[model samples]
Target: MKYLYGLLALYLASWLFTLPADALQQGFFFWRGQLVQLSGALLIALLAALLLMATRPRWLEQRLGGLDHLYLLHKWCGIGAAGLVVLHWLLSKSPRWLIQWGWLTPGARHAHQGASWRGLGMELGELAFYGMLLLVIISLVQALPYGRFRLIHKLGAVLGLMAGLHSLILLSDPLRNTPFGWLTQLACLLVLVAALWSLLGRIGRARRVTGQLEVVSHPAPDLVELAIRLPRAFTRDYQPGQFALLTLDAREGAHPFTILRQDPDTGLTHFAIKGLGDHTRQLVQGCRAGQRVWAEGPYGRFVLPDEGATPQLWIAGGIGITPFFAWLEALARQGQTRCHTRLIYCVERPEEVLHGERLRQLARKSGVALEIHTRQQQGLLDPRPLFTDPQAQCWFCGPQGLGECLASALPAGRLHHERFAFR
Candidate 1:
């Protein structure tokens, strides 16, 4: 949230620096024009930020907290951009409406100029706006299949290209002479470049590694565990609590899943996928041993505390337990545990708990206090009882509602939760 605030502040500052003082002193007619300009600039800036987020830059992930946080920021930017585009469109066309309503006579302050290349630019901008609106709406719709959503979402790149051209063609002369103008031009260029890069399927290409599905296991009714063996030449380094984008099928696109565990000796990366979406259901139904998969990550910053002696409270809900599984595996391999860790595993039903025996075994061997909570028996998790230690760092991976409730109850900055839902 701080990152978003800082971005908004920077945008406002840049806009103010570029806007002429006389524009504010001018009549309502000029004021409306200035408003339109401001809205357009903001819309382009938001689009530029969205484009950069699509690339999943590590630096941004780190700065913004994590990849999940970056996605949240991306979502907000898209919404904001859409709003600004709508405002700009309405303001630009309001003059004609005013004239038609007889609120202003011909050649009056609200009079609209004749159409030209500028009008064509406005038309293209409108088309791009509609495209973006549709994409954003589809992204918000959870019922839509992820593969279809992904394919349709790429149209954003086309919209970005169109928007860049529109901005370049319709920018006012006063703004063109200012520093903001050059910044705008650079932003447009970057947007176009990002769109091209995404359309070319170059995002995260360098980090991608090819692997074959060596094993598949069904630990629960809706869960499928996959073990992907990487090529012998590939040497990958990842923390226990990180995730990777797995591309099982080119048409379905890459979907992010937490790395359950990785065998160092065999170089087999494991993923425990729950059948929650179309992609996961497809993977469960269609994926087989010996199938090829492209993994393009090891991304995220949800690793354990580096130097903390305080007791750690690890809370997981349902499938959110995947990362904790990896952490326990790492702890087991290390042969020693530093801090006192407590794991509260929660699920709607006992049958939904994956690797219950493995978790119990690891907890005993690593000196972790484990508590399993099933809603059917124990009811909702009572987080209030766990806040005894003020110094304890609470790590949560679960439903957003659960995270929010725990976060609000715990001390500020003590509750840490990972963002799982990309959209």
Candidate 2:
């Protein structure tokens, strides 16, 4: 569905490219001005990508209304912008124009000696366009695996710089002549500079903090609960439903983990880790107490809203219950206990339930009904009962399959899923 939405948006926007270059000049703005508008759309697309990268998960939900939709919109908009840029180029230049301009000449010396010095500028713009194309193509479905996406995503930062350069070199006259044109140029320049900084590895380094693992408690097999003492300056904490990536080895990349508990008194960050893979399995099996760990967080936008009417329905599958634990902890800290909260935490086996006792204790204390379902005992998690009672704002985290199941069963506005795997 997301892919379809994205492709459809791109297709609709691509029609903008089909317009003749003289169409804008026929009635309203010139083709140059239309290019500026297209550039503005590109700028907006870049800003959306930035928001997707930088915003915390919990804040994103509230700010963007919902992340899944925003992500879908962002993806589609980006693809459309890429297509428009292609259209813009095709409209701007013809094969005969390239030949006449002598940009297709074999040697650099021939380009220098040509009757048209415009060849150099055209060549540079073409190079930039090709770079943007490469970045956009890699960002799509292909070349995503084997860590190429990270490198290609970084390469995407160069697109803005290239586009800005393209704008400056090609539209210099309009840039200096009109206020709107100048504003467009300035916006592109600012965004381009920002992108350069990100390329230089500056943005991600800004909000990171180094902390030590103060306590480690394995409440269940293959799961490790950690209490991390954060730095004093890192005082402004996150909401209950947020998540962060824990970096035990700063030398290595960060591992995404859900925040299970936050100490209101001391401002310590707590994370729950399930030994799912090589990294986490090692962390659970080898990491000891008092180990120094850097936390690059807190991200994620899965939260119950404060809107007094939306009854919260928490559905956590397997280790997905970690973030909800933080919710309970935060609610308890606030001293506002409500009975309307319905927690449906499910696990594969009865013994696989980590921190089950603590969750039940919190549910009992807060007057929230705790319904536990063990797949080994019941065969499957029956979603019929959970969906029968509508009017519940469902916040869920689990494997992608279960999340999709809940999404299919619930209305658009009702289901909010947080993917710990992706973002």
Candidate 3:
């Protein structure tokens, strides 16, 4: 949220600094031009930020609180860019409509040296705007399949480069002399670099490792468990609750899944994926033993905090229980039996509950109280009944609605939740 506010403040400052002294007195046409300039600057800044975020830099992820928070910010950046595009279009084109309606008269144009270049810039800008608009719309629509959504999302890089070219060519003389212009130029260059990197399919390449699937099993109708054996030379370590991006098929792209188990002795990494989307469904159907796959990550900050003996409540819904499963394994391996922990596992049906016996075994060995809830039998879970200790911290990994409901029932800073879905 601070990052979001900082971007807004930057936009405001740039707009104020670039505005002319007689911006208002110069007439509606002059104000329109200023407004377009301001919107264009803001759009470029947001586009640059989106590209940087796409790179998934680890430092930025930590500084921004987590990759989840980064995605939230990325979402807002897309929305803001879309809004600014609309604003710039209206400001620059409304004068024609006003004149046609006889509400205002046409104003004289200022002569510029690079009129031909500016005309080309305007054409590029218009093309970029429409392309961006389509991309943004497709992204916002939840009904759009993930496969198509992912492919469409990459177009932002292309349109971003075009927008950068447009900005460089059409920048006003006054803006070109100011620090704001220099910053804008820097942003454009970064956007171009990011776009190229994305197009090259080299995102997060350094962290990636190739492995062979040793086991693929179906724990339930919609759930799949995968174990991959990496080469002995591979040396990536992951916290229990972290997730990784797996690329099974080049055309399908990489998808994020929580690391359910990691066996250091055997060099085997495990992941549990539920068939919730097209990609996941494909993974469940096509994945097999001896299949080669790529994984890049060990990303996420959802691991348990080192709060000694503080009573903790762990809640999971459906496949959201994946991370908690990892945490339980870590606890069992470490023999941390003194921590007072309560786990609430919720599912629609008893059959849908994954690793029920294993969870209970781990809980007993680690001295944790476990509660299983079946929606059909027990109805919805009420967190109010479970909040017996005010000092206890609650960790949730579930649907957004469930998290929101629990957050409302608990005190601020007392509840932490995992956000795995990024849009």
Candidate 4:
């Protein structure tokens, strides 16, 4: 958030510096100039950040904390960009509205030769704004099927390119030779390049590796487990709590799934997916033993404590238990028992628990105390009794409302969780 606001302030300062010194005293039209520049600079900054995240740069992923954090930031940028587009629209059309109400008269300055080019820029900008707004609306509708959502979301790249062209056409003439002018042009260039990269489907391309499904089974109702064998080691270093974007079928596109188990020697990875959505249901039903797969990532930073790190409290709700399995498996491989960690699994029913036996055995092997709470057995969770020590680190992956409730009750640095809901 600091980085985002700092960048905005920097851009605002640059644009403000370029404005006429007497801008405040120059009346409505002059103030309008300042307002439009403000809106334009901020809009460009938001789109630049948004498009950059679409590229999924590893360096950016690290700087932003993780791919999970990156997704949250990307969401905010999109929302801000959408609001700014509306602001810009109002600013652009208000003059005509004012004139219609006979409140402001058009001067000879409004009839200049450059007006034609500026009009063209405004037209293009309006079109881009509409395109973006439509996509944003589609994204906000949670009812949209995941497969259809993935397909429609690709149009974001096209809208970003449109916005870039709009920025280029509307750049002010007086600022053409200035450093700020070059900065504005650079923003447009970045937007265009990033859009093209996304449109070409180059995101996470380097980390992607081919694999084949070796085992697919259902242990519980609506639960499907996949064991895939890769031909080579992952492109990026694999971690226990990290996840991969698996392309089970090209038509359904790639979806993020937490790695339940990964064997570096054999290059075998496991994913336990719950059929909560239509796309995931398709994946569960369509998965086959010999089906080809594309795995891109091993992304995320959620990990248990090292030898000297702080003790952690692990909380998993329903399908959220997936990553903890890998953590336990990793600990077992290192022959490290008596690890200072505790895991609490919460589910509505005992039958809904995934890998109940394997989870208990792994927890015992790893020397972590395990607690399973079901609505019928233990009622809903009471987070207060759970957090006995305020200094202990807490890691939660679960339903959003419950996570938020737990987060508020924990200390600032004690709570850690990934934003798994990608949309």
Ordered list by lDDT, greatest first: 3, 1, 4, 2
lDDT of 4 by residue, 8-93 (tens): 87777777678777776787876775677568767877999999998889999888888999999999899999999999888877
Task: Specify the highest-lDDT model's number.
Answer: 3
Model 4 pairs whose backbones collide: none
> lDDT tens digits, residues 322-390, model 3?
888888888889988735788899998999988788888988888878889999999999989889887
Name the runs in model 1 displaced over 4 angstroms: 1-4, 18-24, 106-116, 232-235
Task: Report every candidate's CA lDDT.
Answer: 0.84, 0.65, 0.84, 0.83
Per-candidate TM vs. native?
Answer: 0.92, 0.75, 0.94, 0.94
Please list the residue runs of candidate 4 whose C-alpha ends up more than 4 Å from where it truly belongs after superposition.
110-119, 264-266, 307-310
Q: How well is each residue in 1-423 modelled by candidate 1, as lDDT tens digits?
A: 676577667767877886566755776567777788778877887888999999988788888888888898899888888788889889888888998999965555332333366777887898998888788778877567777778788899999999998988888766887766777787788898998999998888877889899999999988899999976443356888898889999998888899998887777878999888667887887879998899887788887665467888999999999988888888899996744888999999999998899989988888888989999998898889898988998999988889988987898889888887887
Model 1 compared with the native: what TM-score?
Answer: 0.92
- Residue pairs in clash, model 1: none
Superposed by TM-score, candidate 3 places the C-alpha of residue 144 at a distance from the truth, in angstroms, of 2.7
Identify the superior model by TM-score, candidate 1 or candidate 4: 4
